[model samples]
Target chain A: MSTRWLAQPERGNRRLIRLLTWITLKLGRPVARWLLYPICLYFLLFSGRTQRISREYLQRILKRPAGWRDVFRHYHAFASTIHDRVYLLSGRHRYFDIRIEGASALHAILAQKRGCILLGSHLGSFEVLRAHGLFDQQLPITVIMHEAAASNLNAVLHSLHPEIRDHIIPPGTPDTMLAVKERLDQGEMVGILGDRVFGDEKGMTCDFLGKPRMFPEGPFLLAALLQVPVVLFFGLYQGGRQYDIHFEPLADSIHLDRVRRSETLRPWIERYVSRLEHYCRLYPYNWFNFYDLTDDARPSHTAV
Target chain B: MASSPQLGFTTASGLEQDLAKLIVDSLRLEVAPGDIDPAAPLFGDGLGLDSIDMLEIALAVSKRYAVELRSENRAALASLRALAAHIAQQRTS
Candidate 1:
């Protein structure tokens, strides 16, 4: 059970990503999106791991035997989200019709003059949230990411639009906490992907879907220490040029005492996992953790 | 800038030792306070700690020193020497 998502080889290179970006911008979305079918087919035929993982995820979410078509749809959804990123990155959000659910809750949070942790997952287009940032000047958003994975593609994306690169806070660096803290101090939004744990990072086993899966303790711990409000953001790919951006408040404030910090944090994590599961049901093809998430046999103690 | 110099205990080595003890007790590590190298990394290969441990240390520091260590304090968190210095400088007590 390879729980490590970062260890997996990058699917596309810098050249491919740049080419897709160029073609998408030059040819426009509709024609560029037609290219996703062949790309999805390429993965469906060649990437056996992606196919099997897609089936595994689809089976659990769909609650039925997932067939090749379902897997294809899953791949297509992922590819489409990636394609939309080209537009989103370039500040061309007019192409997609994004309906933001819970805008009131978001506005209310922003009303309070405190920074927040925008906990996002890989379920949908995170770029969609950034797209919202482009239009809305009030919501200053920054993403916390592991820059090592897909360095080449990230470099390409950064080169295309340096503003996107400016908003990134890479984890594990000495300045990561400083960057997060500085942004939060300015009453700005700091986004972090709560789904995937990196190599040797401490994680906690929680009931996700129906089985126990390891969820990284880092993000939750950061929230707890900072004692800030946390909001769950999910941008689901509805299909074609439509998306649903959902924002729900996960916690008013995360405070874990030293005595039973682990015990206290467990419920908060479970609630988050349950919400993620609920969203996965709504958009069955959106959940994209490609690793063996159901592998409960991995010793829980290995996290630290 | 560390402004809390009124506590009067100004020895850097002494503060480092105190922080080492605090870390061990807070994280429940098996190592003795003296065993922790002041210059060694608190994360990854040195102490083999993760974000949770770091947060634990932060919480403990906050409670003990009445200092809220924000993310901007990350540079000062890299080693025990640095963290101890930051805590001493920031400690309201």
Candidate 2:
């Protein structure tokens, strides 16, 4: 697929975002959340492309035609997470009830003293995991992000807790691989969003939600190169100050032999896509890929 | 930056040729080792290589030469000759 998401402009300006964040922080969550209804309605009416994309995704997962209410719910879920980030970043995580399901699996991998990859998607609130790592567990976690895509929004949000700026590693730089290697060697957890493909980076087409969708192979390749275990994480927002964070062990180690590289990587990508589909079906509104996922000029290629 | 003495060269040095072979072998490029000009860029339009190819070559170089490539030394990735020189310098230091 193409980088259509990258081309889409940031929705809101910095001043409005800063104002909203300031209000959310000062007024508390319950009072600020009252604002999301009008905001979601505004997007649902104005942002036609996002509304249509959400309806299409909901139709596929819901196995029926999605109604306006469903689309509104999806927008509300997305806005809620964005609002929660204001609190989560400011180190007020205790305000929400986050239920983590698979701690033992993560602990088992961590006990080995070898760094592991936590593969996540745009399914829900990744900030929940970051907050948990920062506050509850005291784990040194670094997030790999594409900073240029949403520069304005990121700049404003990052200013809330400037320390998070130090933990970010942007992809596609000369230092990207070396920095990841150093962190993995130090036995620190590295988080990567495996769903989105950026620029011309290589990708593999896999069956997702009963459709052939392309997923980035960069995260898996990095895991293979670093020879570390991989774990799947999803932080599903359950509405009104509740999040269900789930983690599942993906692979103890990934070894892609050069000769059969495409064949070897196929099953891993399929497994990841299948798990993502499972969660998307479980929590229908959690998926936040606001663009047409299957629309691409390139032919579907199983090989990366 | 001023044009260095190494610019505009057409042929590969001995170390550059070795690195060219390693890159061609690891990335499975169709180009012959001798055909890869030492001064030509290794990424972008020059060799038509991307960031993924850079990682593969870096891994191969680390395995073969026992030298870790750092981001601060990104200039080494400009061409075959520069990388070979960087590796050689790093080995002695």
Candidate 3:
């Protein structure tokens, strides 16, 4: 994390990206599709941060044998998938085929009026849910992302896209539970990336994509105590302006006696990891958790 | 920033244990006081606490101790040592 983009807004970066996207859209989808190359190459070459992640992920994903080329190709494909998804929403394509398989499970939980916890991972462009053509903005979708200080790219997307801005729920101060609980009480469901290590409580180590990665148990714990069902959704990119969105019921009943609370929460967390695997493996390019998911025997108990 | 030193009360360990109990009760963690080293790291992986639990823990700590625990103060949450130290330092006579 040496080169922090947190330094400056760098408006120039935004302008160039806007210009490129505009030209690509104007020039027809064929050439525009091809344009993903140089953009990906630029990021992959410059963002040593992401490249380093690609190398590590390759180790777990390609258990047998993998070379630099495989990692490079995945990065390029990832970049292209990002570009195309952006293009699809930009009206280059009218609508995508996003099929969410388990709406019944979600609807059932929402019926309780106690609120539901949509535990999501950064598996695919979550925004693709909008492309599903069934998403009603009226549905409160609060996404708890880290406090963003940098990334002009985020600023542009957030400002320009209604779908993006409408759904963002940022938590800065410590009182997240009160806020989330308030929202939940309003008969609304809030989504958080529970898979990521939020600098909160000590996190748990679980198997992810055949490797051990630490995951936060707070979301499930909250869900259980709240006595709500937790359903895992898998957003997969099926290409050609289509997505295979599937939701699986992880736990219909989460309450456990005091003796079984911790023991009970483990499987639900693995359920999250399992769904992340399905989505990430199916749409390998769209999963964006590139952080160093290593357990550094390193003391995490230290203060942040 | 830490203020003038306050000598450890014999009750400091008890206070830490009580604080840890509040944490376990609220977060439903499978941890025992013996498992929580008052001087070791608490959030990363030591106690298997996640970021969300961090927020909840702060709430529990504040609610039980009447101490204002702000997440922004990196120094205040440096580790269990720091948190226990904070709890002890701010304890009212």
Candidate 4:
């Protein structure tokens, strides 16, 4: 159940993905979405590792034994998000119904001309926000992610929307801080996923879903270092083409005295884990970290 | 529990040493307080300290100096020298 599973080359062939992306774009969303059921089944049957990981995750969330159908649904939910990414990246978001809450809080922060951090998790699709025209139309958002993790999938998506490539800030670069600082100074939002720890990335263990798991300290540290407002964002799929996105202020500014570094960071990480757990319960299948949710002190290749 | 404290002049270098001792004690760092370079970065390659360590140092500073070290105040925490300068400014104010 190690994250090593994710680091292994992605299962889908490049040509196959190219073909599927073409079909998805040409057939439109509805017909493309139908392909998810069979694709879900194919993975469920062929990929035992994914099935096992899904069952393990579902067991904890459901608080009971998870059946094959539950795992199938989990795979389907994941595939559905991938399928929908086509439309989202292409600016064809009118096909889906999206509900946004706590948008004023974001507007209020932006009104101050002080850019804030949008901290998201792997629980749901981060694309839902951008697809809704929140970027450029409402405010600018720059995504901070490791470019190498999903190079293949990213290549396809980048090809569809060439402008998005410019907004990405890859981690581990010397100028990463300068780039982010420049963007923030310009009153633009920077989004980062906070749940997983990338390889060699320093992280601390915190209680998550009644167990201890490692959460990356980098995002929180960056937020505190930058001394910007931090907001929690969740983009959830409520089945079909409907998505519910929620935003809540997590911290005004993360300040920790060296002595109380762990003490302060512990509570922040816990609060985030609790919020993630809450959504996982509401939409169990939406939580998609296909690995054992245990303490990963050593960095995972998939995390970045 | 004597209230009266001995008052003496502490030189700039002396104050820096004291601050370094505070950081070492606060973070339980392996290196000796005297080993820390005043001009070297407190983080990254200098002390090999991480973000959490920086936070711990900030907390110690706040408790001992009664001075708030915010994340935005990068100049204050850039290095031991910068931090000492910030502390001196805070004491004067």
Which candidate's TM-score is highest? 2
What TM-score does the predicted chain A of each candidate obtain versus native chain A?
0.91, 0.93, 0.79, 0.92
lDDT of 1 by residue, B1-93 (tens): 133434455688987887788889878899999999999989878898765567667767767666777666777778998888887767644
What's the TM-score of every candidate structure? Answer: 0.87, 0.90, 0.67, 0.76
Candidate 4 lDDT, tens digit per residue, A170-242? Answer: 7643345556766877888888888887655677887777788888877777676668788898999888989
Better of 1 and 4 by lDDT: 1
Pairwise DockQ winner, candidates 1 and 2: 2
Best by lDDT: 2
Root-mean-square deviation of each candidate, in angstroms? 4.5, 5.8, 8.4, 6.9
Over A38-72, each residue of candidate 3 has an lDDT whose tens digit, in order, gives: 65555555766666776777666656555657666
Score residue B2 of candidate 4 by CA lDDT.
Answer: 20
Query: Which ranking of candidates, highest TM-score first?
Result: 2, 1, 4, 3
- Better model by DockQ, 1 or 4? 1
Better of 1 and 4 by TM-score: 1
Give the alpha carbon lDDT tens digit for every residue of B1-93 in model 2: 231323332444776877888899988899999999888988777887766677778888888777778656789988898899898877767
**Interface-residue RMSD per candidate?**
3.4, 1.9, 5.6, 6.9
Q: Over the stretch A130-208, how does candidate 1's per-residue lDDT look in tens digits?
A: 8778556657898886453446555665565676666777776545665676687788889988876765766788877
| Poorly placed runs, candidate 1 (over 4 Å) | A1-11, A148-150, A296-304, B1-5, B55-75, B82-93
Best by DockQ: 2
Q: Model 4: how far is A75 from its true place, Å?
A: 0.4
* Runs of candidate 4 exceeding 4 Å displacement: A1-11, A133-136, A148-150, A295-299, B1-93
| Model 1 per-residue lDDT at A250 | 88
Off by over 4 Å in 2: A1-11, A148-150, A297-304, B1-12
